[model samples]
Target: MSMWSFILLLISVQCVFGTSSDADETLSVMEDDSVTLHADVSAIKREDQILWRFGPENSRIAEIYKQNMPTYDINERFVDRLEMSIQTGSLTIKNIGIQHSGLYKVTIISNGGTSEKRFRVIVCARLPIPNITRDSSQCSSSSYCSLLCSVVNVSAVTLSWYKGNSLLSSISVSDLSISLSLPLEVEYQENNIYSCVINNPITNQTTHLNITQLCQPCADTTRCGSAEAVIRLVVSVVVGVATVAVLVDHFRSVSDTSPLVP
Candidate 1:
C-alpha cells in the first residue's frame, strides 16, 4: 500500500476501537442547588482514563482523571466549589448559579483508543418572595380592597391568587410586577386573609404571599372608657406626687424656722 493509504487505514482502525468501549459506559447529571454528575466507566477497559471539560461550547477543561488518579484544573469561578472523584467518575459542583449552566464533555481514553460523551448542565434562578399589600381607601362597600402583588429578583413569573385553599385567579406576565383587585361580592368582613403565590418554571421555584385585611377604627365603648380611665389615673398620680412634695417643702421650712420659738 502507498504511504497515504497506510495512514488512513490506521486512523480508521483507531476510530472503530475508540467507539467499541463506549457502548456500555453512561453519564448523567442531577441538579438542585448544585449539580452532581455521575459517570460509569466500569465496563470499559481497566487502563482507561477519564477527562471532564465544561463551558458554553465545551472549550475549557474543568477536571481530569486517570486510573483512579485525578488532576483538577477548574476555572476561577469554580475554584473551591467544584470537586471530582476519580474512582466513581463523579463530579459535584456546589452553589450552581445561572452562569454555570452550559455543556459538559467527558472523554475516556485508553491505550487502544478514545471516546467522548457530552452532557448539558442547567442552573436555575431562585424565586422571589411575593409582597402583598392592600389599599383601604380604594375599598368601599361596593368594591373590595385592591391588593398588590410584587416580586423581586425575577423578571418573569406567574402570579396566582388563592382564597383559603381554593385558587381564585391566575395571571402570567413577562414583567415582575402585578396586582389583583378583589370584588366585594360576598360578606367579606375585616381581617380576612388572602394569599398570592408566584411560580417560576425555569428555576422550579415557588413563593407565597400573605395578605391581611386593612385596619379599621375600633367602636368598643367599654374598652375606650377603660383606656381613658387609665390615662386619667396616671395623670392624677403624677399631680398628687408634685402637690405632696410642695406641701412637704413648705411644712419643712415653716417647722425649721418655728422650731427655735418652740
Candidate 2:
C-alpha cells in the first residue's frame, strides 16, 4: 500500500474504534425508588461488563455484573436493599433513605473501551407533626379569631386546611409558618374541628385544633367561678399536706433525740 493510503486507513480504523467506545450511558431514578443504569452497548461486539458504584466520588462498589453473572459487594447499610440485573444493565435500589442520597456511577467495560455515567440521588426527611392553634379572641364571633398552622424544621412547605378529612383550602409558602383565616360564613359549631396538613414531596404531617364557641354569659361567669374554686381547693390541699409533712418530720426528729437518752 502507498504511504498516504496506509496513513488514511490507520486514521479510519482509529475513528471507528473511538466511535464504538463512546456508548451512550445514562442513569435515572425510577418512580419505585429504584436507580436505573442503562447504556447502549450495541457498538461494542465483545463481552461487555457492567459495574455500579455509589457515593460522592464513586469510591464504593455497590455491585458488579460481568459476562451475565452477578457479584455484589455492597456496604452493610445496603446489603439487602441494593440489587442489579446484568441482562439489561439496570440497578434497583429499594427503600431509599436519607443515607442513600448521593451520586451513583455506572461503568461499562468492553474490548472497545470503557465508558461511565453519573446520576444524583436525593432523599427527603420525614415530615414533622403540624401544630394548629387559635391565635386570639376568646369568642368564636370575634373577627380576630385566626387559626395558625406551623410546621417546624420543615422545608418546601405545602400547607393545607381540612375539615373532617375534606380539603377546604391549600396554600404553598416558602417558609414553615402558614396562617389561615377562619371563614366567617362557617357556623360556629362547624369550626370546632379544624385540621392542618403540612407536606412536602417526600413526607407529610398533620395536626388538629378544637375551637369551642364560648357562650359569653355562661362561660365568663360560670367558668371563672369554677376555676377560682378549684384553684382555692388545690392550694388548701397543698398547704395542708405541707403542714402535715412538717409536723411529722418535727415529731420524728424529736423522737430520735429522745431515744438517744436510752
Candidate 3:
C-alpha cells in the first residue's frame, strides 16, 4: 500500500479500538431550554479563531473569527438559536429541541496547531405530571384495587409504579406521543402505599395512591341507619296528609246533601 493509504488504515484501526485522537465532552439539556457549551478558550487571542460543527457528518453550525476582521457567522440550520462569544469562544443554544441534539465538534486554531473538541449532546423533554386514577370497574373491596398511571405530551420519558423503592411496573417511550399509560394492582389495606412516577433525565413527577382511600367499600352501617330513619319520617308525613284529605272530602259531601233539606 502507498504511504498515505497505510497511514489512513492505521487511523481507522485506532478508531475501531476506541482510541480516536478526538477530545469530547458530554452535555445534557432539557428541551425548550438553553445550554452553554464551554470551549475553555480563555487564552484565545486576537489571532486565533473557532469553528463549530454539529451532527455525525459535521455540518457547519457556527464560526467565530478574530483574525484580520472579526466576525460571527451561524448557519441556517441553527438560525436564531445559536450565539457565540468572542472572548471565550463558547457557544450557547437557545430553546433547543430534539433535532438539535447530537455530536458537536469544534475546530480551534491556536499557536500550537488545529485541535478539536467534541461534545455529545443529549436533549430531553421535561416530563409531565402523571395521573394516578383508580380503575373503579376493575376494583373489588374484598381483594385488590387497580390503578392506572398516564401522561400526555411525552417524549423520551419513562412512567413507572413503585411500592416504596421497589419498582412494580414501568413503560419507556422514546418517541413523542399524545398519551402513555401503565397499570398496577395491589391488595386493599389501610397502610398500603403506591406511587406513580414519570421522569426524564432532567425532570420527574410523582403522585401517590393509597388503597384505603381508593378501594373503600360502600357506605358503612352507621350512615345506613341514618338513611333509613329519614325514609321512615317521609313516609309517615305522607300518610298523615292523605288521611286529612280523605276526612275533608267526606265532610264536604255530607254538607252538600243536607243543604238542600235546609
Backbone clashes (count) for model 2: 0
Q: What Cα-based lDDT does every candidate model obtain? A: 0.55, 0.57, 0.72
Can you rank all candidates by TM-score, best first?
3, 1, 2
Deviation (Å) of 4 in candidate 2: 61
The TM-scores, one per candidate, come to 0.56, 0.51, 0.66
RMSD of each: 15.4, 16.9, 10.6
Q: How close to the true structure is residue 215 of candidate 1, measured as C-alpha lDDT?
A: 28
Instruction: Identify the leading candidate in terms of lDDT.
Output: 3
* lDDT for each residue of candidate 2 in 1-262, tens digit (9 for 90 to 100): 7754453343333222222222243222222365544544443233777777776455655444345456777567577886666555666778665456556777787776888876655444455676665444544343344556666554344678887878888766433223433322233445456677876554567766655542122235566889999999999999999999999999999988884444
Model 3 stretches with alpha carbons more than 4 Å out: 1-23, 67-77, 175-178, 210-213, 218-262
- Residue lDDT tens for model 3, 1-262: 7754454344323222322334477666777999898887885687687888886677777777764332444566577888888677788999887667667887899777898888766666566788877776664434666778889876556789998889888987654345888988777664756799987666789988866667666345567789999999999999999999999999999988884544
Q: How do all the candidates rank in terms of lDDT, highest first? A: 3, 2, 1
Cα shift from native, residue 220, model 1 (Å): 18
